[model samples]
Target: MPSLRVLNHAFRAWRRNRAWAKHEPETPFLADLLSGAPTCLHVGASDGRHSYVMTQVAPKAVIYAFEPSAFAFEVLKLGIAWHRMGKQVTAIHAAVADKPGELMLVTPKKSSGRMGRAYAYVAETKPNGPARPDLEDTGMETQMTPVVTLDAFCADHAIDRVDFIRMDIEGAEQRALEGAALILDRDHPHVLLEIHPPMLQARFGGSGEAVVDLFLKRGYRMFALDGVRLEERTTLVADLPWKDYFFIHPSRAARLPDGVFKARMAA
Candidate 1:
């Protein structure tokens, strides 16, 4: 049984997630991408909320769920099993980074402001950018978690093509991308990332600009998608905080409807 504090924290996190779900609901471009995508990747997938949603939104899609938290991974597993979605979703308990090795991760309980966000920062961040003020002490001790690279994992699993990838792995986004060069170069899968400057600073020792560069360097056109209107971005600014950004691999841009990547016109 979980402790009272853990249970209470979970309840609060769920409440915040529900509110965000109501406000942000999934977008159409995502629907289009998932419609026929044979495979999808969901990193930092906590409790399978989005995974379950994806199974419905993209009935033909096979989703990969990666989470580093043991407590959360168990819940995520249970959720997938409860929904009878074993065939469509596969869960892994590893953190993806620029290299394959072990690293210490500092995890804060799901107690973030704005929308109950939890964060796991790499203990030793060779960040590409400067650090910002710590959001909070978090006070949680560091835990050893297995680290894997996207490129290596794909090779080992023999996954030739990937259609879409949604990542929100705290702040190790850059490192994860850094390790996925081969896959991106070959498939150019649509990459959706959640960017948090403070978290990036705290964890990766880098900035959002660095995160964006990881894709742009590999021939991807990136856009900020959290706004009511989607806009292409050369880089991310810490002052201009954004949640989700989409990167299209040039080849699939014409296939998607404009509205999925365009601004919503007032009715």
Candidate 2:
């Protein structure tokens, strides 16, 4: 077995790369959320890498990460146990879908590491057509597994509210939200969502704006769009095409202090 120091270093490296970008150009929205040390719910947290960050920043808060992939769930559980944070962190072996039950979890045969249903959209829109390509060439496979909606899971677990939510469920954001209407209506947590426009349009017949509209109608405000566009330092795209967006409830906007806001502006 690897030494404890070695394991810690390895876990840190994995989080730095696979988790949210630590050095990415900061935005007021993210700084605001991180500064508050809020309780969070992470949807489709494949291996709970980002969940680690949440716990680090908010040691007193609770985090529930929902993941369906067996391999990913196993590793995530190991990471949580290794850190002795089994109490602060809760890992669920379920995917966020239209309902609480089983569904297909498609992944590349060779690289189950990058498994996600969002990839299904890419598969469906492949230029050649809709057919399972060679595993080596495509690096994915379509497998079935049980999925559950966040709302149902929360209800079953007796979770009353969430302060923040991070969703990266491939292209299943809309469905997840549809099932989480109660949480959105009652708890009003800040949400950080990754919306793949092409995938949303191709697979779900929905536009990215529709997802944004869902939150907007529920009294949430778009705070920032973080990712490639900021790093590239170019004006070509003008708007972020492929990236993560952060949204927060307007009522809680005052929780973000001026110092945090200034730090992000400097970044």
Highest TM-score: give the candidate number: 1
Candidate 1 per-residue lDDT, tens place, 152-231, comes to 88889888888788888766787788888888888888887887777677656777878777788877887765445566
Q: Model 1 — TM-score against the truth? A: 0.79
Q: How does residue 65 of candidate 1 score in lDDT?
A: 89
Write the residue-wise lDDT of candidate 2 on 1-267 in tens digits: 545644654476466644555633432244456554466788877656667767666677688898776656666777787666788898888778667767766564334454433344222232333323322333545545567777788889888877888888766787778888888888887787777665566555666777888887886656453343222111112344456766667666566545443333334
TM-score of each: 0.79, 0.74
* Clashes (candidate 2): 6
Q: How many backbone clashes does candidate 1 have?
A: 2
